[model samples]
Target: MLPADDREIDLKTLKFVQYYIELGLQAFDDWSNFNVVDQFQTASLRYQLYEIVYSLATYQAVYAPSLRGKVCEAMRNSIEKSLTPKVMGYWKWESLLGKWSLDWDPIKKDNIMVSGYMLKALALYTGNTGDMRYTEPDSLPFQVTKNAVYKHDIHSINKYVLRNWDDSNFCIFPCEPNWNYTACNVIAAAGSVGYDRVFNQRNFERRRERFLKHLKEDMCDESGTLLPIKSTFTGFTIPGILGPVGESVSAVDTAFIDVPTSARVWSVIKHENIELDPKSGNYKLKGLSGADFIDMGSYMPSTGAAFLSFAFLANEYGDYEISENLIKQADEVESPIEELPTGSLRNKGISVWVGGFGLRARLIRFRDWTNTVVNGPPKQCINGPVLDGYDFQNVLVAKAYSPNGEDLELVLYNGRSAGSFSLRLAQLAPNASYKVSNGASFVADQNGTGIISVKLDGRTEVFTEKVQKV
Candidate 1:
């Protein structure tokens, strides 16, 4: 495990990660076959399922394989069952035997947003597992039975974007009757990249570049934020369904789609207007698409979504200070183990989505130590507590165990200014003499807990070492 290193991190971060993972898994389990559409009188099950699947795939991509294996297995199994002939052919919703099925007509299909999300999830799964079954020419959703014939290949999901490209160089299909969404267009554009990556084809780069140009030059406002919705026929900005939050909210009012999309396509549409709040230190974006409702706040969850999203992006770009502050603020609203609703957002509730964002936050905060890359190494952990202390906020952490399991390796990243701090370690050998790699002093208690004192003299100090038993 990386030669038993010592690192510093906020212990609360680990707790939050565990909390969000539990919350997400519980929500998925409670869905019990995702039959909530009939149970809750909601028609947005397709989008909801996509969110759940993406989050699940993220879990699989980031966490330790041993810890996340069973969960990922279950998710993959459910995905195969969820796909039907009708769903494979057309993205529509149908009613079957008192249950709602995602077998709608062509006109009723969810916009390219849903299509993009589904494609992304599948692509990520394929990338992670190196599974080529999805890339075959006649695979139902896309006929991959033939080896070399590209004609009539429905599995060429990339065609979904190419065929629907408008003169504006972006997709603008009607998600509902006449309303098209800008967020959907952008997501579909990003999905084109995933499509190419999965199939090893090169049909989307030019289209993607043109769409990105349209966004930078025409779609953004004075502050450089993309307008949330537009008309399909007229190619004009219009107030419409914001995103997966549903039609009850305006696209311009919520951060749901904008923040997540920013994380996915930051290279193309980096938003400079999303600023950090001076008072709370939370990165706040002003926009609310839907009316305030129970379980889902108009601004709270959306704000949290934006923070978590930025945290993910910051981690990717190696901006740990931004990532840490964003993660802390996100924890305030989207805690790991809050009481979440089990049913759909339009009818029963949407606490699960909040938890989904929380899960993403945890993934971002700990990515320095976890499998941040989709095709990176598997999950690895040290034998003892990686972190067990609190004081002077804003830091990242990682840990590993000695092969003999007699000692712990720790790594602490102080992302803030210089300061003195207290650290606690849990689950170690009780009342044992210990040696710190940094020449610090500490002792374990009867309960196997230990405390260490640290003095950081700079804004960016990474403390790493092997804490051996004496």
Candidate 2:
């Protein structure tokens, strides 16, 4: 039964690999932009670039034709210089930021924790070159050339800290701030290489306990029905549904209100010490611990993500679906189901790909606001302009004309597309259903543009544009 015609398949795979590499090279002008800063966002990006090149360097036996010398040059110029001891050891400076010169700022202000995922990119990309050293301040080099890798100060996946900003509830990021997913990839991404210990101390045991306690107490009702809680991410304080964050604060404590999540709930179930109850379904961990659950007017995009991630979490924890109405709630958007993303599509109709599974979770607020004040009088307002009454999670493609007559655009970011389809629309001419199709394939490829068949063999194409309406 073991057929020996594997050559054809192997050849086909090799061709596809070659084609993909060619696409990257073509997009970058034969890899000319190797040293460019465009790709530099986190140490992770550089690390990934280098890792791709390094893999090509060693595995060229099969794909050697695609790994050009320019690629190697770019890799060397961008990442190799950052491996020195002083740069690596400095806790305040994440060497990965060398590309942008932004210096190393932790995702959150209080903790020494940097991202573990970033550290992994560095180790994988630089480990074999014997470039990393004991540069971290006060600590010795992680290694001398040819020395075995040691337990250096790196990041961990399951990191938690006590509530900062003077709050009663304690909260933690599954790994660190932003990227949220309490899954196995985090564990592997933290310990993939032979070495284990990184800069951040092991925080899993404690975080696990607190999370379970919060789930039991805040995420359920008196009868044990589950409530959608997201207090840790958003940082609103009441009921700890969101935790106390900048947005969590209002103009004044007395007149303040918790931010609202686009999601809703009809029933409240009780679990074991779920500290806070975010009535609004905000994305905070500790804040949700304090508030009582709200009955959903209906399913909302903002809350849909909570249900998705939490449902998966439940399944991971051994709970199986009994009735399956959760799916109906998740897929029920006003638009035709196939064309409408789960409120997570960007104006570009693009999905987020976080952790390793590439699921869209962390939504980006392109404008950095912490630098300025957000609330109160103009003179007192310092945080960059906090988004005004905007819920990023539920937008798909909203364009209300601005006062000046230009289109003000908004799009969804609540979740990501996870299939093999597309939705093609020629124009937004109303009184009609735009062309629709499955969007999974394009999403998985991280692509956002394509052609669509409108009728029997009839189709049209459109490029996603982040444009203002005229």
Candidate 3:
């Protein structure tokens, strides 16, 4: 008997995503009014905004289809406003006084790293919403497109990034001052992949493949964990300065960057490093060579939310349970309904980045047709305990389909403790037939819902089958 309400949890999670997105949007709106000086800060802030907006759009694409176009429009607007004007195929940074000074090194202003993230934003927008306003001249939204600083030159940026694919064969160097960031290259490569997805082009397949191969072999630490930085000159992972502090492979950084080279990396990470408490779904880190190197003291306030970004990644990599566990951990640390979560080390206390991760996690659970192959079957939300529970702790449930897609499989897990409990299932068609593992039978009523009571001895598992429609 978990004290938590499924509807309550859902509402809180929804609010968490919405509140943080709004927070980020409002913060950026305020910042847009001011003349921002630091190029790094501006790029970083816009990246965060793009990420949250993209996550929101992903969620709306499935669960709230009516809001999809609106959210995509919002993402486009944010990208336009966030990008500084370009000069000679690069972002032109401005000073606190709103003037682009010649004193600013034009080369340094080639913020390909930020551009990579912006590309990711645009690519995700196109991927999720199928909105082609930026691509088609006839469809361009006039008010939103007018005077926009950023334009979708995905091919040009892709070519620029590809041209700089270094001798290391792994890293993508956007510029010299930012050479150490291995994650930026991961993002840049992902941007290329996204571009291919949007335009039906295979221009960078060989390049992306080579980039991934080298990244897996050369950029990982001794333990195969993705290191935060690899020196441009040295071609090896090393302790590096992030903002003002130095660290090795920081969790927050890994969450921010570390684009998975492939699905296999997620398998490796799930097996090698992540330790999810079977009962609570609360997670802890392991296997990094320099765990102490991370500034935990600096991360304390936002550590939980920062980890949510990793949870979001876990979701992206087909580790939905791991992501769910991480989300549970985040909720326990700071209830989203009470106060907003904080940001990672670089931008601590910023509520929007916090929301961005939350939204990312929530969107991962949304029902999408595209997800059918990766995620076995459509799942009904359980009203009972998941991960952490009061009465029946550690119980797990997954919905799957038989090989022919003629029957549904409900895989169940009872971790560490067991008791009899009742659970509700939603979204089944009315009068659908169902069978329990223990020779029991049930059917959904007119409302397409059902409740089942079961007794589980300690540390037991079970299954149920749903018959497909005739």
Model 2 over residues 1-470: C-alpha lDDT tens digits? 01011101122222222222222233322333122222222222333333333222222211121112232333343233333322234433333332233333332222212233334333332332222342343232231122322233322211212222123253323322332222212222222221222222333333434544543354344643333233454633233333221111111110111111101111111132112334733222222332222211111123333333333222222233411222223334311123223221111111111110101111101110110011111211111111122212221111111111111111112113222222332123123222222221121111222233211111212223223221
**What C-alpha lDDT, on a 0 to 100 scale, does residue 445 get in candidate 1?**
83
Q: Give candidate 3's whole-model lDDT.
A: 0.45
Residue-level lDDT of model 3, residues 1-470, one tens digit each, is 11111111232344444443343344333653222323353234454555565555544433433122223445666665554332112333332123344433222233445556656666666654455655643222212122532334545555556566644344455333434455566555556666776677765566655655665576666656555566556675546333111112122223222333333455565665568666764677555433232322222234554455556556655667777776666565533334423311112332444446556555554222123111211222221111111121233332112222223333333334466666554445578787777677788677665666667653233344566452
Q: What would the TM-scores of all predictions be?
A: 0.53, 0.26, 0.56
What's the C-alpha lDDT at position 359 in model 1? 47
Error (Å) of candidate 2 at residue 260 is 32
As for candidate 3, its clashing pairs are none
> What 10-residue stretch in candidate 2 is worst by lDDT?
363-372
Candidate 2 segments exceeding 4 Å error? 1-104, 107-114, 126-171, 174-229, 233-470
Report how far residue 81 has shifted in candidate 3, in Å. 2.2
**Residue 197 of model 1: what lDDT?**
52
Candidate 3 has a TM-score of: 0.56
Candidate order by lDDT, decreasing, is 3, 1, 2
Looking at model 3, residue 298 earns an lDDT score of 25
Candidate 1: worst 10 consecutive residues by lDDT?
Answer: 247-256
Kindly give the number of clashing pairs for every candidate: 34, 85, 0
Each model's C-alpha lDDT?
Answer: 0.43, 0.25, 0.45
